[model samples]
Target: MKPEFENIPLIKNEEKKRFEIQYNGHFAFIDCKEMSRQIALIHTEAEPELSGTGAAAAVVEKTLMYIENSGKKLLPFCPYVFAFIKKHPEWKRIVDEKFEGYNQL
Candidate 1:
């Protein structure tokens, strides 16, 4: 079996409108919003120092986990999330591929 994502400390920055994972003062984030039964992912970002560290991958996993557990489907608008899906095809079940802008990718 693939290794399950570890639970990293995260802050739900409601005011900032994103879930953030901070490390050594730098951070990675997944910006999302709920729309009825869907959770639209607005974007994903990671500090340059944390890039390629799997921090963003963990953020994407946790974001999808939160949406799935909340009984919502996903509209993965973020390019990072789409790339994450390409690497983790098992997550495809929760993706709403019919979303407009995502089709162009």
Candidate 2:
């Protein structure tokens, strides 16, 4: 059976520099760094059990929505986030063009 991702709450844990979600007894998160009016999405991860269940995508989608609604630009430094935006061009509106090819380690 597929894991349910609906109705999950994404939490912006600024103290930890990551947005987090609790699911099935595990925690999934996306690391980020906020600077001025831009936010750099640096990394994303989910528990092994959450992998392949669309949890990562959900987190990224919600994070992007938050960024858009907050009127901040996105610097997708995380490969997953960059790829996600590439696949979903609608999100390009919030992406910082200057950082289009930025994938730092």
Model 1 lDDT tens row, 1-105: 113336466677889889787765789899888778898888999999986777787777878878777788888878888888777777777877677744444
Candidate 2 weakest ten by summed lDDT: 96-105
| TM-scores for the candidates | 0.80, 0.88
State each model's CA lDDT, in order.
0.77, 0.84
Hey, what RMSD does candidate 1 come out at? 3.1
Clashing pairs in 2: none
Task: Kindly give the stretch of ten consecutive residues in candidate 1 with the minimal lDDT sum.
Answer: 1-10
- Kindly report which residue stretches of model 1 are placed more than 4 angstroms away from their true locations once superposed: 1-5, 100-105
Prediction 1 TM-score vs. true: 0.80
Error of 1 at 25 (Å): 2.2
